[model samples]
Target: MISVYIGMGSNLDGPVAQLEQAILTLTNHTELHNIAVSPIYSSKPVGPQDQPDYANAVMRLDTKLSAIALLDLLQSVEQEQRRVRDRHWGPRTLDLDILLYGDELIDTPRLSVPHPYMLERGFVIQPLNDLSPELMLANGRRVQEHLSQLDTSDLVIIKEV
Candidate 1:
């Protein structure tokens, strides 16, 4: 099995409930195992200020599926949760991204492991730190160390998982 870290977010249609449902879906899926989650955080919108704040968290799981297959699974969960990609970083019922696929580096037209923006996003790193404080990204930075320098002043613990 390969270990993977995934980021989850929602800002529309009851953000917390959306995340909860998606988590349930993932944990119940046959391909994923040894699942773990972090406390949820509420943060301001990353791209636009007009939308409501987002509910976000990070999840770690072991899976036998390939990285692309896992990405397909996440996208399916998002769609099931009514995720509408009407605008870029606009608003959605759910958004899931693969933050890391084990320690392997990957970049493809369909997906990218070690998600490009994860290091800079406090919402991502904070919960990620909670789940795996000793976790290191492909770039060699520990989750805790990277989180220490972020301005997570806006990230509030909305729920503990």
Candidate 2:
């Protein structure tokens, strides 16, 4: 089984509920199991701050599916949750991004493993640290180390949600 970390977020239509449903959806998939989720965080929108803030979190899944298959599953989940690609960084009902897949580094037209922006986004980094501080990347960098390199002072965890 390959270990994959996914970042989930939403800004529209009860973000927290959507995230919970997404997790349930993942767990219901037979090929995926042992899902570990980080605490939910409220983050300021990345691209356009004018948009509603997003509730974000990370999930670690042990799955028998290949990277491409996992990507397909994620897309299907987004569609099930009514995610629309209206604009770049636009508001959506759900956003599921594969942050990392085992120790693999992949660059493909359909999907990129070890997500291209995993290290750069505080939303991704903070939850990653929460889930597994000692988790190491393919490049031998720890989750806590990457989080330390980021400015996450503005990121706030929403414990109640």
Candidate 3:
């Protein structure tokens, strides 16, 4: 199994419950095991301000699935949670992103590992730091190093899972 870090967020249809249920679904998946989740955080929306704030968290999973296959599973989970992608970074019942897939750096039409913008997004960095502060990115930078450069003023801890 490989280590995978996933970023989960929700702003619609009871954001907290949506996140909780999504985590539960991941834990129940046969291919995904040893799931560890960080504390839930409430953050201002990254896109249109018209939508509500999002509840976000990071999940660490040991998985036997390939990166693309894992992406498919996450999308399915979003669909099951009634996610709609009508708008970019729009409000959704659930949003799951493959933040880091082991130490591999992948850039394909469908997926990007290290999440491209993770270093700039406090919502992703904060919880990721909570999970593994010493984690090194594909490029070799430490998780806490990137996190320290971000402005986390918009993020607030809701509670542990």
Candidate 4:
């Protein structure tokens, strides 16, 4: 099985509940195992500031499927939760991204591993740090070191979320 990290966020239709439910869905998936999730964080929208703040978290799981196959499953989960792509970085019921895929460097037209913008996004960095502080990103920086370089003052841990 391949170890993978998935980033999940929501800003519409009860963001917290949406996130919690998505985690449950991933946990229940038959093909996934040893699932672990980070504490959710609340942060300003990464795109248009006009939208509601986002609830974000990161998940780690072991899967027997290929990257593309896992992406398909994640997209299906988003669609099942009514995610819409009406606008770039727009409000979404659920937005799931493949942050890392077992240290693989994937660059397909449909996906990119180590998520292109992850290192710079507080919403992604903070929660990811919560799960694996010592994790070494593909860029050769420890997760803790990378997280420290970013301004995470705006990130608020949503305890018991």
Per-model TM-score, in order, reads: 0.98, 0.96, 0.97, 0.97
Q: Model 4 — TM-score against the truth? A: 0.97
Lowest lDDT block of 10, candidate 2: 152-161
- Pairs that clash in candidate 2: none
Cα distance off (Å), candidate 1, residue 38: 0.3
Candidate with best lDDT: 3
> 1 or 2, which is superior by TM-score?
1
Global Cα lDDT for candidate 1: 0.92
Span of 10 residues, lowest total lDDT, candidate 1: 133-142
Q: In angstroms, how far off is 15's CA in candidate 2?
A: 0.6
For residue 75, what is the lDDT in candidate 4? 98
Instruction: Tell me how far candidate 4 lies from the true structure as C-alpha RMSD in angstroms.
Output: 0.9
What is the TM-score of candidate 3? 0.97
RMSD of 2: 1.2
| lDDT computed for candidate 2 | 0.90
Candidate 1 C-alpha lDDT tens digits along 31-65: 99999999899999999789999999999999999
lDDT, residue 137, model 4: 80
- RMSD, model 1, all Cα superposed? 0.7
Instruction: State the displacement of the C-alpha of residue 26, model 3, in Å, after optimal TM-score superposition.
Output: 0.5
Model 1 clash pairs are none
What value does the lDDT take at residue 74 in candidate 1? 93
